[model samples]
Target: MLTSGRKGLEASARGTTVLLAALVLASCASGEPEAKIEHLCNVADASEEEALLRGILRADDYTTDINNRTSRVVEGLERNLRDIGPAKETLSTSMCAYKPTPRAGSDRARFEFGWVPRTSKDAEPLLSGGGRFDANGAFGESNYFQTRLFVRCDMPGDLAEPSKAAWLYARASYSFNIGRTDIDQAAKDRQTALAYLMARRVTDALGCENKPLEKPPVVKPAPTP
Candidate 1:
């Protein structure tokens, strides 16, 4: 009877050990994907540029939108360039659109990034292509400044599949009412800086080959006669 009881106790101990191991494996399996997603989407650190924007806009706080799927948008408030009496409600300071799983072809990837090949004779490039990056900008009716950047990068995993690629799109804008018809140089600089900063972060997270965005992107100056 004593030997039988000892045998039963050993069997119970073995079962409990097996159950614990299974639980641990289950936990790891469930957590691994989420951990990868978190790393993939991590871009929380933009404090210096955020502070610059806040100071320029005289805003106390800013709001952020981050998700595992598509994009991140951050908005803030600024004092109207024309009317200093009241603050304008919201201005989109930065936007970042990422494509994690690009389609099969390079053209498909560009289309996914919202650019399609131009079929018309008068069509123009969405972004002025130059340097190591592509960029463009314009002044709004309010005379505020806006700029955008585009970059193509190698996808993080499965280097064996060289065709796998990703794209990062970033934009920054300032909204204000002013009498001037041209873009505000100071505001333009700030917006461009922020857009580049956000794009750099995305590339860094993805471990892209063309990352670091070493040079400041340029918007070609108007033609000289």
Candidate 2:
């Protein structure tokens, strides 16, 4: 009887352990999944990654770099449109002009990623909302590594309004995480990643689909002696 009681106790403990393990796993599964991101790349001759990232840094004059890039696109468009002869009047409003709309959720205090632009740069918030990244040895903080962006283009003669304006009107918001780090080399790696992303966004906003940004001029490493 004593032996039987001991065996029963052991079995019950094992069962409890399994149940607890399952619950923990289920809890994790219920939470949002983290995304995997690629590591940054650098060529032997390319500027160090930190420099690359800095290239994309928010202009000191403005807090949001993406917004500034977006504004540049808008400026170029408006400049061209102003000279487009008689088609200017048909366009209703500057598509580059955008107003901020609030996010519909209760987590406003912890996170403020949404943008209601007071100016062109304010229209879109860069890199909001946390995301998971798996970049080899790189660790990412949600606050630094996640980004969201949306650009709207109304080309005058769509189905909804078919008057006659045949120009592109666009608005865009972009966000991304630069990760958390202090090392200069590491910072460069992250910056390269951001520069690649930012360049793509700017090129797209500029309608450079067919003609992408010019490729970096290749430098043949000096002939090995």
TM-score of each: 0.41, 0.22
Please, what are the lDDT tens digits per residue for candidate 2 over residues 1-225? Answer: 011122333556677677777777776898834332111121122344224333433221111111233454445444444444432222222221111122222211111111111223332333343332322211222234332222222322222122123223222122322233432434333433443333333435545433232343121112212
Report RMSD (Å) for each prediction in the order shown.
19.5, 19.6
Across 109-207, the per-residue lDDT of candidate 1 in tens digits comes to 000111111122111233322112234432111114335454554444453133132123444433331233554555555555555655565555445
Location of the lowest summed lDDT over 10 successive residues in candidate 2: 107-116
Model 1: pairs clashing at backbone N, Cα or C within 3 Å? none
lDDT of 2 at 76: 45
Q: Output candidate 2 Cα RMSD.
A: 19.6
> Using lDDT as the measure, which candidate wins?
1
What TM-score should be assigned to candidate 1? 0.41
